[model samples]
Target: MYTLILISTMTNLSEIRALVLPYYEDVALICAIITALPVLVGIILYLSKNHISKPSTPKDAEALVEYKKYFTEKELEKLEVPYVQRIENNIERDVIEEAADFLKSSEQVLIICGESGIGKTKLAIEISIKINESKELTGNFKFKGNCLFANLRHYKNPKDIEEKLNAKLSEKTVLIFDDYQYNMEVFNEIKNKALRRNSKLIITTRPIFVKALKEKIGEVSIRKIKLGRMDINGILKDLEDGDLKKVERISEGNPAIALLALDYIREDPDRNAKEVFQGIRTSKDFFDKIIKDFQKEYGEDFIEFLAEGELTGGVANIPQEYEKTMIEMEKSGHIAKHESKYHLTPDVLSEYLINREFFSGTILKHSFEELARADNGTYILEMLNSIMKIKDDREIYRKAAAKLLEIVDQLEPNAEQKKKRIKTGIMVYDGFGSLNLVTEKLKEFWTDYDILQDGKDLLDLGIFLIKISKPYEARKCLEKAEEIFSKNHDKVGISSTSHSLGIIYQQQGNYEEAVKKYNQSLEMKEELGDKSGIAITLYQLGNIHYSQGNYEEAVKKYNQSLEMNKKPGDKSGIAKTLHQLGMIHHDKGNYEEAVKKYNQSLEIKEELGDKSGIAITLHQLGNIHYSQGNYEEAVKKYNQSLKIKEELGDKSGIAKTLHQLDRIKKDMDRLKEKMGEENFEKAYQKIESNNK
Candidate 1:
């Protein structure tokens, strides 16, 4: 009976399995189809999107051919010869890399903005090349298209831009509008079409147009890259040192102007870069246009005020009545606002404005009192210095000197005012005026005021004269100051005058006299327990020792100064002492020691926000690397140094760093020739990879 029951159960189970098996199979089939359906649909969509048919008609083909030709012409075939990569910050990332990333992202428009002649157009072209090469793009949306460029300045009417751009707008293309005029209506039309077609656009424009462009674009996806001055050391390798300095001064990082200056130099080899730049017809025309526009927009009064502001180191104290005008100027990128003051843009424009006002006699029209009231007469002095630097005409200098002398004569006999007048008189004589005339007038003028009354005034005047390279004049002032201070029993004043005399003698290459004076100051500082003053005197003594090639003596003095500075927590003094020690080591060919010292100094400078010091240290580090034949490392250090120097507007430092870079380039070229191209390339790649 049990066997029969088992057999019956097995048969019933088998029947139940047969019934469920078919349904299970159907469910599995449905699951498979559901899983595969989305993928199949994606494939279909991709194929359809990518494999659209082209126009087959003859007219369409011809039109397509014409468009291709136009685009080919518009495309930047390659970067300009001797292109210098421009970095926006201390980071190694360049503008081209940043712009390429923007293109790869969802941003539909990239605007390159900067001052005129700051290479905005060149930057745009570089970005175009980067996009075409597809080198930096690593994103979901990759650009695979023709890069086309157009200068909007060539297109007079908005309608014409619309018509020309219509043929170029597509998913597989990018259009760059160079020198965009911020035509909102035309941009809107093009942008709307570009959005629908999924194309990107780039605009190169002056910073003045950026605000209008943004306001016009509204909510459209956009990005902006601002170009600044780049290291043109490589480009200027052929220039003489004098010419290089002249170009650095005038170009102010504008490569186009630098090149133009170079061309002028080539044309008239006798004329220097400054002379060529001053006489450039194009620059004159450009300034003429700017002056005319400014006069038309804001009137002659505004221009005069701007000239005054320019004279005062680009700062202008805006009155309430002209506040609105200043706001407009700031928005237009003609000026920058800083704490209730407006600074003129491009700084170079200051030269033009001052020259214009001076030649027009607009500057002379102001009362001496009015001029003196402005920044304690700094504007008048700055105007004179600027005119002296730009103009070679002795007649112009004489006229300016006469005006300065007149202003000096009107100043009150107050100690501070008298010092200023005397300084101005000395500056006039030093620059262009007759020394005897200025001296006799100063002598007569000083007789009216008792110089012995204020030792501080005479001391200050002595220091000022020292700075202006009039060591003899400075010595006389210092001697008188010392006498007055001794009579008044002013120990601090006497010590300072002694130190000033040391600096004067030191600068004149009289190490023995400098040492004697420095010893006198040092003794007084030690007696008064003036730790900072002692450190400073010791540092000056170290400099004297260094100049005289007394390495051991210099090191001893520097170490003593360093210890004193540390005790006082004078970070600046400490950094400077460390830097001096590093220089000694560098001169001694102790590169390792030099680097260590520089690094120590660099740490403090970085902490203190001492950009100038940091630049100096970085350059020193580059020198060490160069001496050690670490060319790649040397270049990295140099670039780091150059970036800081450029930011600080240390034109001389920039030129020096560039000179080093040029040297490195020449060295590398020689190496390449010696090692053969293939071997050099392999070695360079190895070094680069290792650095990465």
Candidate 2:
């Protein structure tokens, strides 16, 4: 119609132009839409590919929202158990009240000691709240956030926060220094200032810190409160219907473990409580989560630093850059700051880091060498030897031992420090796994060291002989040491000699003599309050019982040792005890229980990267399968064991696994032949029946 109008009206130029313009405009609009379709389609595809679903928010976190301004509520919640104003007749509550009362007393510092997850931080928080609400001091008391929980290192400017702290020292500020175990300079500075300002300094840390604090600050009358587990009956009643008793036993009275169990029960409601409790202890994933958080907050390098320091008996100088991090770690309960050095909190965490790839042979050797160069480095050398004994990493120990030997040899010959370090290394030759090297070093330096001048030298020589598998020589040296210790009235030395002699008797299969000597050692250790020595003697006794097939008695001794081991986070001891338990179960035809215990031991071994330990566990598992008539599974497990043994250069282990594989093959062949005979019999019977 527009065309007709334009054609009809020669003078209708405006109409024609208008129609053309409209047509062009419509075409342009269509072109624009076509172009946009591809772009729109691409954007849609891109969004679909890259999209991530949002995580569901935690409802439990809502309860913590009010304290968000003072802390990262989520982080604080992780650091401590949920707050409780009062638990009737609770031991932890009593400790809190005592600590709070101490804060109001003339005491300048209050030290609270307990194992991790025992509600130390929670107790501190409650005390702070109580003190703050009551205006316990001059002005309205201000509760500073948990010092250990604060990441002062990550702060944009730490000086500003420090200045604010200094400015508020005149006020009724309750500075809660949770888990202070290292950086004595900072601790001393803060302690002095807090005392000068009359501000309350409340500290919560591992029991080891009490010893460390005493070492750092000298004998100050700081009121010490040791937090124990809450009463079991009340906890059971409070938890309502659940395996609270099992939780109590497995968690060993740890509030954190109980809380975690409650969380699991609330989540599934049907999962076995005992199993859930065990999962918390044995699950690698749970440990990984805690370790990841520690690493994220303080960084892996700082963790490495702490681990190396611990290997040296918690002796290390905190770098200026790490000062804030150290404080934050202490506050967070990941580490403890006592004076100038730092120690990791929850000994298990230290064990985890020690077994990590970050603590490689090279790194360990470097740390050892660094300590060897420091003043009183001999103490660190002794500590290294002790750690190496627990680790049993032959290659790692060899490298470190050689380096230490070299360092001591090069030291001003005849120097007391040099002799002391050499003696320390010699005392732990069994741990070093370098009998020939240590022997050579010993011979080369013997005369120069004049080791016979001191009674302790005989102890070192005796330990070296024992490690070298020369029981006869060990007996002679230990007897000499005993004589010297007796003459010198060194009760501790005599006890040590008795322990060394016990090891010799054990090696010689003289169980009676071994037990007698170990008992002597145990009695002395108990008298000296040396829990570690007592644990070692008890474990040795368990070994004797296991060898004699007295499984029940062995378990009793092992359990006692295990309880003591728990205090120090002795993973090696735990794994050894578990492995022994697996052996007992296997001997008793408890295949399922044996498998569980073996798997648990294997997990810890794998974490420690103890290839020999892993192979041993695998072999035991194969034995269990073989007993159960699972030939194929037995073969698989045997092969896995063989592979690891071969990699470890364990000739005896490889040979043992090979023999097992041969046995399995023969068993398989016999099984097939028996099956064939049975099938023939069935065929014959079928034919006879048909014929009839």
Candidate 3:
């Protein structure tokens, strides 16, 4: 094409050359403009097309993203399960099954109740699924109805929840009325809707509310399936990867508590529920330990408040004394002290305590044959040794404690049962320290967490030991514990056990092992929607790195942990982790950083009156002063710590203060020697003046 153009140009030669040269420039410029036209047009079309076809975000997607910007997938999933996992084992199960049956029969308003976490919504889900499957099987071309689940907690109006459910129910004709525990108005509305639409209504609620409704509305036509003991097979299935004893021990014949048991045991098929019970018992005792410690600060008032039950229609504050007592207990952390009233954190904890005490032949509930050999009578005497120590118990408290102890002494503890018994014993003693005399009788089992013999028990008991400074023993206990959860079919248990093992490893010197265990724990936590647990593990992993002198690694771990912790309102744990981080900074000579950590810890301690923890920070501050050669200041801190230790009668704390005081003295002497008598006297005087 160039040659042809050149040839054409040459045709005009000679005289045409001058005309061609000027004309050629003009023609060439025109050609360049023409060539650029297609490219420019193509670029404009591409930009216009991009603008026209830009992706559009659906309203749901945008709203969902915005809602989730502050939450995690694990946290968001919580909104899906409206059931609290409470209620008696068989009662809850039967209710759910019956709810399904009634729904299948197109009965409207299947009422649900009998305590929190009763698997009400869970049963509703099951009922819905049953209906759905039956519809699919109906030889009908299409099932035009759909299933609806709505929680009353999220809505001020049951009508609104009904509206939402209706949108979905119209498609499947099955509606789940959850949180029916108190919202009778909403319950009746759903009942009416179910009747009108010829749809099924599976109502989940507490019997108190149901009774109230029955009384008010005059016995509405609905199936009254009381949720009680879960199906035994279902219990085992939930504990599929766990043990029978665990289902037995933690569950205590109630499927409700068994759900939490899934948070602890890593069951092996070779091991039955009885074996997993070992894990459950340990977790129960561990939690009891925490509660009892809080109880000590607040007194037994909280326990009673917690045990007193939360069903307002059934129970109310008796008088000024009980109310005051409840407030005190709440302050001490035994109860969630909201609005100056108390409720057990959840019904599950109460049931765990009650069932573990009375029904099943757990060590706590066992007949003490070994003691009876000496004299079962003497064992009751021994049990009273501790029961006599608790402050401000009404007759009911003493009677309850004594009876529970009598049961404990009479039973023969299998290794697993023995471990649980020992754990409960330790918890009792620890909770009511005035009962140290009783601890001596149970001394053989004091450190017998090891004797419990399960992977989860060993690991968790090991972590507990670390806090109390029984490192060598803790290490030994955790040593027997496995790294990964047993490849048991109980997937839920596996995750919890894995997390326990990770925590143990983290406490030990093996950081790599710790990380590995933590990762496994994290995976399990994620699968289970346990954000609080995950955050705690992450923080712990960071601490492991900090211990190994990896500050950056520690910070990263802490940040990750904090992010998760904040979502769950785990303030106490968050404060503690921040304290560790401050230490890392202080060790690195980052005084500001260190101060930040201690300050955060200090704030929480102040709010909590965590005297024992406050002692630790005061001690740290003294060290920080000593590091800067401020001997007088160090001594002042040491004195402050000593004062607290004295107030609390904390032997270990007293020892710490003594150590700090000795160091301060030595530093003062060295400073005196370095400056010489005359100048040092002047320097000491200056220090004294500044200190004043």
User: For each predicted model, how many residue pairs clash, with residues at least 3 apart or on different chains?
Assistant: 0, 12, 49
Candidate 2 deviant stretches above 4 angstroms: 1-468, 563-569, 607-612, 639-651, 665-692
Q: lDDT by residue for model 2 over 160-235, one digit each (tens)?
A: 2455456545443345432233233444555665555545455666664455565654545666666655655555
Which is the better candidate, 2 or 3, if ranked by TM-score?
Answer: 2
Q: Give me the runs in candidate 1 sitting further than 4 Å from their true place.
A: 1-121, 124-128, 137-255, 258-277, 285-301, 308-320, 327-352, 360-379, 382-421, 425-456, 464-476, 482-495, 504-538, 544-553, 556-583, 586-692
Model 3, range 220-253, lDDT digits (tens) per residue?
A: 4666665554544454544343355445544644
lDDT of 1 at 437: 47
Weakest 10 consecutive residues of candidate 1 by summed lDDT: 1-10
TM-score of every candidate: 0.43, 0.43, 0.40
User: How close is each model in CA RMSD to the real structure?
Assistant: 23.1, 23.6, 32.9
Which candidate ranks first by lDDT, i.e. highest? 1
Model 1 C-alpha lDDT versus the unseen true structure: 0.64
- lDDT values for all models: 0.64, 0.60, 0.52
Q: What is the full ranking by lDDT, best candidate first?
A: 1, 2, 3
Error of 3 at 453 (Å): 6.9
Candidate 2 — worst ten consecutive residues by lDDT sum?
1-10
